[model samples]
Target: MRATSIGAVLSGALVLSASAVTAPAAYAAETGVVIQKVSVNGGKPIVLGTSQTESFTISVTASDDSGISSKLAFLQIKREVGDNYWSYHGTPTCTASSATTSTCKLTFKLDSGWGVPRNTLAGPWKVVVQLQSKDGDLYNNGGDITHPVLRRGKLSVDAGPEPVAKGKSLRVTGKLSRANWDKRTYAGYTNQPVKLQFRKAGTSTYTTVKTVNTNSTGNLSTTVTASADGYWRWSFAGTSTTSAVNAAGDYVDVR
Candidate 1:
């Protein structure tokens, strides 16, 4: 994952104030720690991309009946957007195997690109966790496993008339965005329902060549006729606060 931990903590200043929705500060269970489950990404609702870097995977279940320890396993993430409040913290990799139970499989990421500089501010994000035990015990709360649908989004495409002539009529455009973070970018994702793939130059697979709906602003035109000459993309397949996306294969040249 070494993208430099995706900006292990890139920030000169973020201030904090996503309008509200902040919850973090209420720990004092005498420090014995016991979180049982916390699954994100796998729980679905993640499709962030302002440029790249989206390696998702978060699975944690901690315990410390005064008998589980061996370092630390943390993953604190928060978000707001509007005013600010976009935090990050990750250590990942905790395992007690079974005894007192301690399991973690963290690999979370949300890089805004520019070499993992993390510009921060995307959408819903909240996964507080901290399981440290080496006699200094400390396990923050996440009780019901954070929520807010765990959303994230960002998508856009534009496979145009690079060179169509075999049968003419090869017009495909796109833009079904999502991800505002108060206005970090991408916003047109209105009528949803986008999918129009095709791959055939050297074919590896990609069939669907229909289904289009995204107007009012999400834009996405349609028109296909030329045959053979592969590559073209646009797939959404995500709902529940946006997630799925596929746009990066624009190559057409049927002559």
Candidate 2:
């Protein structure tokens, strides 16, 4: 049969192999198989950069009255409302914990430039698990779990005029950027909230001094009164589509 849509493409082209099984319309009610848990990237977001390939792990735990089959499992990470998808291309390593429960894990590698063609594709994505039990019960679902797939963020900080007198204004500058998969480079992440932090010369802690928003070009320039010897840096809390990042501290001395 010819595939027509994104779901169909997954169901037919990549998921219909000899070892793969598509859930029948009534598979849910007739089966005792239960997908107990699903974890992607160890419960953290899958972050990607422009040129380097990022590899992540997916794990599916399922149980049934009968033990799961020995066949390797299949997993698909796909966008909630788009054609973007990343699928496992190798065999999953399945380990049986008991007579009825098994956990299957697979690793998938994604090349940002080749795998992701659109920046809008960043955000929450769902996973589909396909497996069968020894007693013929099937478990294939896409709605039970979701994870964020994001672009890696980059931040730079510069705080200057060394040995400034106390109570004098110090100029702090920075820029926030993130991976652009389509352009295969890094670009500014404009209009995002970033926190300016300071750590005293002898302390191991950093406290927020102020919150500044990146301008049109993701550039940050702010002024603060020098109080003591400390390190200044910019910290981005990040958003749904971008990962959080902190710039290396720029030390300033106050005389």
Best by lDDT: 2
Candidate 2 residue lDDT tens string, 61-113: 77778888856367777663456544333457878999988889888766533
Q: Write the per-residue lDDT of candidate 1 for residues 103-200, one digit (tens) a residue.
A: 77667545642121223443346667667755677766663234332234445566656777788888878676665444445568788887888889
Model 2 lDDT, residue 200, Cα: 97
Model 1 per-residue lDDT at 251: 77
- Report the Cα lDDT for candidate 1: 0.59
Per-model CA lDDT versus the true structure: 0.59, 0.72
Q: Which segments of model 2 are wrong by more than 4 Å?
A: 1-29, 80-91, 111-114
Model 2 whole-model lDDT (C-alpha atoms): 0.72
Q: Lowest summed-lDDT stretch of 10 residues in model 1? A: 1-10
Candidate 2 scores a C-alpha RMSD against the true structure in Å of 10.5
TM per model?
0.36, 0.82
TM-score of 1: 0.36
